[model samples]
Target chain A: MTDQRDDKEFAAFLAGESELADRYQALGSEQPPVELDEHILAAARDAAKVHRLEFGPPGGWLKPVALAATVLLSFSLVMKIGVDSPVRYEQVVTVSKESDSTLEGQSEPVFYEQLARSLPQRTLEMKNMREEQQSEQVIEEVTVTGRSRSIELKDAPMAVSILGSAEQSIDQDAALLIVAEYVAMLKTKSDSGRFRLQEMERSNESTAKEPALTASSPVASKKDWESIDKLQTEDDSESMLREIVRLYTSGSNNEAGTRLDEFLAHYPDHPVSVKLRRRGY
Target chain B: MLPGMANRPDDKVLMVRYRDGEVQAFEVLYARHKGPLYRYFLRRGLGTEPAAELAQEVWMKIIRTKDRYEPSAKFTTYMYRLAHNCLIDLSRRSAYKITQQVIGDDIDVAGLPATATANPEAEAIYNESVEQFRSALANLPDEQREAFILKQESGLSLADIAHVTGVSTETAKSRLRYAFSKLRQQLIRNRDKA
Candidate 1:
């Protein structure tokens, strides 16, 4: 489908073999004017000058100085931030502490009110402990007295028939009953003597001789007995009723009955006495 | 290649050296291509003044965009592509003016730079043939004329002509073939009339 003439012409064009090429070369001998050449060369030189200024030589100091300044600025910024952070944190902590103190001050009255409310309960606990201690002391005194009487009786001649062996044994039992009654009376003052009982049980063997030595002296026993008598006189009816209950729990019905009678005699019109009477004490 | 062109550095190297702030490299490059580039614009249907101006503009543009020039293609291809684009831009800006100029006149050989000829009579005949060739080139269609001009002015490969004119190699070859066939016909017709 191709024309041979067109192919020849295309081939000649590729080979640059046409007469038109030589003529075209002659036609293209025209050069740009000298003034135009001067203008362009001057422009190129000026451009190269501008390029040199913009992209300085590789050996120039400006780049190194710029890099150093950048590094120094970065280091300074980091150091400043690092130095300031702890102070800022401390300021925050101080503010928090101040706020906490203000809250503590605001809550002080509530704390005192709670303390005031707890005082009576604490006082009741102390009173119970003291009463239990007193009861124990009374038992110790009674035991010492029984033993001293036995010793006295032994030291006396056999002709002293007024305090024989049988009489001595009966007196010991009666003394035991008296000590139990006294313990029942003091026990009324306590809501709970469980802690005191535990302490006594632990210390009983170790401290058995200590109280005997202290209470064996007549003067010491009298002083302790006077304190017990004063406590009994000042004992309130409510605590006396509690003693009756404690004696009942201890399987000492006679002692409980005696204490109940004494409590009724002291406070006949008392509400606790009325309750006790209803309970058939 | 021109006389002593082989002795000098490559065009791409000269451009690279110029890009690195060497004025002498750019001067050498300007000297090497200025005439051909001016004639390229002239053969593309531009008057001498306009051709000179466009050639200057192309060089200035090359100077402006020196940093962007990559050595990926032949320097001739790159330069001609820029020249082609400038020509297209000028045509778009004043299509009527360029059309009138293209149709108005043929090249005046007297006004052209003198060649170092050994014989004056042979030179005169060659000059007449050159004038006829210029007329025939101007009469050719714009694409064919540009294809022919790139071929003559830059001595670029057919592929390079295709690259500069943004055409396929086959299309560039076809344009060049048609240009040569028409120019030969015009020259023969003009000679026969004379």
Candidate 2:
């Protein structure tokens, strides 16, 4: 019961203050040394410099240039690998089977030989045929090692005729012919890969001559599409700003100013900028 | 002390001037707050030297963070908060423990020259009461002690105390209440003994 009373008494005593509070006030009223003022002010100045160092330079142009380079390089690589490699060109071809009555027995082999060479070139020309006639034209015959298939060519008035003799087989499927032509083109292009490789080597040599241009150009850095996994994570802006400020206040004003200008341009309404403006930067 | 300087520009404006290479504005700010800040550390069991050192440190922190200053709060609030943190930091570094011995701790009350033989009995009573009060204040929790100091010495409102200590007004009030209760109990005990 007395402990409870003491708790109440304690509360009341604290509420009912004494002159000790006044005495404490008097003790604290003593004047501080004059040097203290200078010390603190100097500290504040140094702190201001630190703040300036942490938040000084804006990096406006550098970011966009970096982003543009990244985007352009990425897009160029993707196009180079994905969408551009399989393009097809078509042309129409007129086929005529030679009647070799003198070499009747050997005529089949000669016909097959000529057919193999002419078939691919003929297919190449077929794709260049006008779109209106594309559907009607077809491969009337296809022979692989004497096993032959004959397909009926649609005889529409617009159809481009592909004539062949009775001994030869013709497959007149338009879609199959188109695909075959595309495959043949791919083969031809692949066969000439060494020449293209030589051309690439020459371009690379020329590129090395103008290093600055190569470095600046977006197209020069195009890598394989799969290598995009190597892209760096974005840097932390606050730390970057700190570094920029440090650079600025440490007598690199021009570099710092450029970075600061860049940052302000990028983030016009940033709180850091407000602080910078207030600091008379 | 100059006329119309009572409604002076805020710290932010002064800081901006300072940033513009005007050192005088910084001096003015230093002059205005240095005494109070020094007193703040002194009252919190720090010696004159330590108080001055901490005051300098607080000001230095202010300078370092000047470029990041937002005038969302009063300059005094910001400065005192810095001082408070610096004191806490110093205490941690020095491992300084403040004892609650009142008159016997640093000064010898019995050794002081007698001011009045006429009221020796009353003087003894007063001294005892003051000692109990100091003991109770020392016994309070750190938060309560801080709240009481901020209120009693800094003359900050409960709201202002909350802002300085990063507590809500209700928490500040609660701490004050606890502090008051503890001190009141000690005072009453001294009165009972008398």
What does chain B score (TM) in every candidate?
0.83, 0.67
What share of the reference contacts survives in each candidate?
A: 0.75, 0.32
Q: Write the per-residue lDDT of candidate 1 for residues A1-281, one digit (tens) a residue.
A: 34787677667766877777777766647778899999999999999898889886444666897999999999999988765442210000012344446545222222222222232333343345444333332111112211111111111121112112212432222222333323322233223311134322233233221121122234223533443344444446535644554454445566766776787789866533443343344
lDDT value for model 1: 0.60
**All candidates' lDDT scores?**
0.60, 0.51
Q: What TM-score would candidate 1 get against the native?
A: 0.50
What DockQ do you compute for every candidate structure? 0.39, 0.16
Q: Number of the top candidate by lDDT?
A: 1
TM-score of chain A of each: 0.26, 0.23
Query: What is the per-residue lDDT of model 2 for residues A1-281, given as tens digits with 9 covering 90 to 100?
Result: 97797556545434434444653442324456767665666665565455446544235355687799999999999977764343333222322334454435433333334434454445545567655444443543434333332221222111121112111212222112222222222122233211122322242244222111112112112321111111112123433443343343244545655766676676555544433443344
| Candidate 1 error regions (>4 Å) | A1-9, A58-281, B1-5, B100-127, B187-194
lDDT of 2 at B182: 67
